[model samples]
Target: MADGHHWNIVKIPPIVQELAAGVHEPPSQYMVGEKDRPAIAGSDMPEPIPVVDLSRLFASNGYGNDMVVSEKQILNWCDRDVLREYTVRCREITSLVLKKLAKLLGLSEGYLVDMFDEKAMTYARFNYYPRCPRPDNVFGLKPHSDASVITIVAIDDSVSGLQLLRQGVWYDVPIVPNALLINVGDGIEIMSNGLFKGPGHRVVTNAESERVSLAMFYTLDPEKELEPVPELVDDEKRPRQYVKVKTKDYVTGLFETLARGTRVIDTVKISDNLNEIVS
Candidate 1:
């Protein structure tokens, strides 16, 4: 049985392969804004890239009931039946992960979960990168940290393209079947008072095969003001490292300054206190 912690891969619907094979055109309908529309620079991408938004699949009034997402845009790429199955399983996984994270931080089991009330926003994106002849010359996806509190990625089991930069070196993320990769995002870094760092990651294309990935991002309500949790901050020891900012503003700034390996988090970083005299 698929539960909050574990998913029975065999029982879960296999829609990823179907969606990847079915998409032949770019996913312009699902773009969040003009900036989100995928672009290529000088033959950077030689194939069609489609993104399917699956956030509305679990809406209270069934798919397409959400005001933030368009029915036509979602229906353009996702099958209602398949998406229904996928959403249920993914939500369970997210809940379990949030509980675990809270426990790790020495908080109540529901501490993190409560932060994501009905006003919270959850976005799921399905990215398909087609095969490229000269894969070495082009990048599938550029390096950037996520803007959400947490991101869950379901990678293509057959092909590998995801890589992470750590300690000035790039390391490939192996493709493991039925395994999910969870990444801490900028929001988590702020909320955790910099205890968790959002790592930079990118994707590279393959010469012979196509790659597909599903990423689910959990974010706080856009109108909510975000800052470090008070419990995690100590005035003299672990002082606040970030300034408070509305979630919407932070996301807007992220898109305006999007770039490979760019750290949008730095823009809102709190400066060091100069009030104290130095010897």
Candidate 2:
């Protein structure tokens, strides 16, 4: 997908000599260097060879990560356990982090995770964004925070699609090996009385290759009433910043608001007078 800006195409000619156009043997620049009089190449290879091409790569559109795409659906019914096991592991990690967050916010260690102990409403979504010719006109997912307490996402390393808004600028999310992206949700911001922030983020389609991302949302029991922790609010220092509401209602409202291209958090957020944010 396009970055924050748009790009126009520019044409350029190929190398000086096309093999069939007649410069017979390999050129001097083709050799390794003066050290290797004749670099052994072609035929059956014993080891991997190093090849470098700058102009060709730079002239290409989109990211120049030269990789072949899979022609078939690799995972099938036989991979059921793989999916189940992965979600289980993700839930376990989420529980651990929730417990730590509970303690960090001056609440009991089990405070956050306990809501899920009885009946958790955790779920996941698998996304596939196909390559688009005009990426700027379309978006995989619009800007919105997860309705759950926390969401953990993993994206394909070959292509990048996720972007987060910061100070009015949209920045592409780079893939970090061996790490998953964690997004704080509105629930956390409300529960913490605005101590934490749930950023606005979206997905941008790739112009060259298709992209895929997996996000797991950790939610509380549907019937549980969500609100700011009592300890976080006071008469002077910190007044309530968000209106109290049930998880089901909040979630339902989130979808309804999102469909209209609006943020539901703004509705719950208090304005000036007594409802204003604490200084």
Candidate 3:
């Protein structure tokens, strides 16, 4: 991507994925007053990114060269090896994470890993916020929890806006520079029988500089059903805390609930547990 040569998106037609559904009127959520966009990949930009790619980045998904993605999930990009390696590494990292979480819950190491099949889906979402003159007026993202089993956010720039809700107040998440933030999602909370809780977070606009955050969402097959794992739910203390639902249905309901400005995890809970998780 450092090369000065520009690529045409008119031919391949890069993916124009929407971060939010139904409110698709030029992604005003990501807009800021036109200024200099800071370098996302750390220092030294050797060349200028073409207008087509830059517009796409500003239009929700382009990010200079969004050729790496499509609704089909497989575009004929020359640098496909990077995407392949990225997905493979994500699988390995998340698999290890699940095993550790399973052990933490006193369940078998492979217990949670077995739930996510080979056909499961993984998605990469990138949100770019240009330097805003009126930071108080705009919000980059609203307070919502992920619908996936886990969401890993790679902070690509120095500007800070991510914040988490705790107890009753919102706290800014400190930037660690090139660090990844691992978030517990709604699916994990269900599988753990409410032992784990998803976090509520939002992104406020920053007046200093531009920022880009790349989030990876890992989910089970759309057809797979999820519930409080049988091992975690017993006749004793830990009864079934979550209602069983297919992945597709839950995801559909998640979008709907988000649109309604409510947390979907609360809707799926059969018992009143961790009501403080997301509010």
Highest TM-score scorer? 3
Q: Give the alpha carbon lDDT tens digit for every residue of 154-205 in model 1.
A: 8999987887767755667765577778788899898888888888777876
Q: Write the per-residue lDDT of candidate 3 for residues 190-262, one digit (tens) a residue.
A: 8998899988877876656668888888999989987888888775576677788888788888889876668
Worst 10 residues of 2 by lDDT: 36-45
- How high is the lDDT of residue 103 in model 1? 84
> Which ranges of candidate 2 are over 4 A from the true structure?
1-78, 274-279
Ten contiguous residues with the weakest lDDT in model 3: 48-57
Residue 156, model 2, lDDT: 86
Give lDDT per model, in order.
0.71, 0.70, 0.71
Better candidate by TM-score, 2 or 3: 3
In model 3, pairs of residues that clash are 56-62, 57-63
TM-score per model over all chains: 0.70, 0.69, 0.70
Best of the two (1, 3) by TM-score:
3
Answer with 2 or 3, whichever has the higher lDDT. 3
Give me the overall lDDT of model 1. 0.71
